[model samples]
Target: MTETLRASAPPVATGAGAIAVLRDLASYVDARAEAFSARSSWLVAAATHLAGEPVVVVAHEDGQVVGLAALSVTRHRGTARVTLLGGELNDYGQLHHDGPRAARALAGALVDWLRAQRRWSLDLTQLAPEDPALAALVRLLPGAVVSPGAPMPRIEGVGTSYRVKRDRRRKATGAFNAAGRDGLRAEKLVLDDLAGLERWLPALVEVRRARDHASGRRSQLDDPGVLAFHTSVVRGAVAAGAGVVHVMLVEDEVAGFVTVLVDGDTHRLYDGRVAERWLAYRGGTVCDIEAVLRAQDDPGVHTFDWLRGWTEAKFGNAEVVRAGLHASSHPSVDRLDRWEATARRRLKAALPDAAVRRIVSR
Candidate 1:
């Protein structure tokens, strides 16, 4: 964890070298983040995908990817938004480090890289409270609000309630029964028993897209790689003996769904979506609740994170709220506000009332 301060941050200047970092990342990430991030390929792939983009920067450690930062640039709505591409499901940094100081060094390197690139700002998704890298970033960049655009969703554990929490015996079981009586079913998939995800991906994508269209929003399913990555997540989760994709079928229909990220000690829910048609049943909550019940089966799991944004249900139900930290050197809390104003002005001038969406390249 000791500091080995480098004179400069790493970037992909030469095509051959950038390709090397991508490959090294793909390999080392396969090992370092192997167990931590369930979908190791996607996190590692972030560097590979961003390598081809016009603007992308990565921090290298001895020709290996000890750390990386991806920026997804778009000039939508006449304003620019740079998505600080990390994990879409959670706003957490998965740096390859031996200790906290190693993580900090990487953070400093990434912030410096971004600033050098002249990016207006960045948006990190699904921010986690325990990320020490982000903590160090806040130390360097005092002006960044960790929670700017994206809001973390609400989350709760089955055992964190009163009626079932009075005693430890049967906590999850009690909650599951209550949910079932309320017309919700909670269960995990037997990896071998279900259809191959190669087959499931397309159908799942359709369901997700339709759900999004019905909600008047764009489905993440629109992107082929994003869809592929999600598909990989399902496959990886099952292969690791980690957890299953819990589905909340309403009246024998895929009413809501959530992919639970699992390890021995942590269980996280991602891609949680509920159809607008199921509002009466709180379909989203139903799926979320069911996922938690299934997670309880893993006695080793102690923390259930909503993973990024704050939500009404998650805050109300969770006994412990993991507050995410945002550290940046921007030095002005009003920077985001100022950028937003510029974006608004640019949008009006450029498109003249047309909805401008900056196409984010991988």
Candidate 2:
């Protein structure tokens, strides 16, 4: 396939203009009937909220929308980042097409466009090492580096066989029991029966903030765009039977919260946070346990994945039955060989390469 690069064209990218493009994106995704990253309603919602001064690029072949990707340019620390926005949204997402070289072409076009912006660097965190789509990225962007984002653990799932490891099951059960003895409790709340949306949003954000404080991490809920996306898209998921929010609470206060996308019989764990003080209770890890088990309990729901991870917490743990991430993102040539090697070398220089390799390998 020949490469066709197109920058974010304006006529189709204004606030109202993007709607049609976004709709096209959604339609292109559905046309595949293939599980896709850009297809998630929640992600689209998040993008719609955060896509300020952003660029939307589309790839075409013989007049058909073969592939597309969005770049949200957000100003951070006096610099603008062409972020792929892979959070609760698309951490484990891959190229949206199965056609020959379509994924690679899409990725290459995006990287070439980003380089045109004349930015200091392009940041793509937590892309799976062997993704074919990224194969073209290194060639396009010669100085890019790949690094781990947040550490999100997941269970392995195959064609029709996906299960959490025995050790993880044992430890999760033990953690649940131990925490339970200390007055820690976690219940997956179904807001289906809740009175109305007026009250849920506030409690929702508050619970998330508390959980993040407990986990010693920032709360995504505190972000206006993220919270708004949840409120808007979650309603749609519930209506479609593909959306459910799992609230993990310790007693009366909210310990942690996760908003999951129940697409058919499978559930993709999306955005989440754990209260900081609850770290002693393994709030984040255990919260994942509680959410995953709840998803598994439903006969309609069979799989749960914590989108992406480069940290040791989720990726290298037993909780992951399978371990891979969104295989998108372009890294420079040297960094491609050891995508995370530099970071590992500097921070973990004291340790042996093998030991650091396990922790840093995505």
* Best by the TM-score measure: 2
How close is each model in CA RMSD to the real structure?
7.5, 8.6
Per-residue CA lDDT of model 1 for 241-321, tens digit only, reads 665665544454555566666645667665666655444545556566656655555566665656655665453244332
TM-scores of the candidates in the order shown: 0.61, 0.63
Lowest lDDT sum, 10 consecutive residues, model 1, at: 353-362
Residue 233 deviation, candidate 2, in Å?
3.7
lDDT for each residue of candidate 2 in 1-362, tens digit (9 for 90 to 100) = 21212223232253445444655466455555323344535346656775455455656656555666554566543334555544335554444554547777677667666655553345444455565655566666554444445554555442235545577667756655666788666554554433433345466677666655444445566667766766676666656656566554566555556666665655666666666555555545665665666765666664566665544444322242112222223334224435556765676667665664444332
Error of 1 at 117 (Å): 3.2
Overall local distance difference test of candidate 2: 0.53
How many steric clashes does model 1 contain? Answer: 20
Q: Candidate 1, after superposition: displacement of residue 130 in Å?
A: 7.0
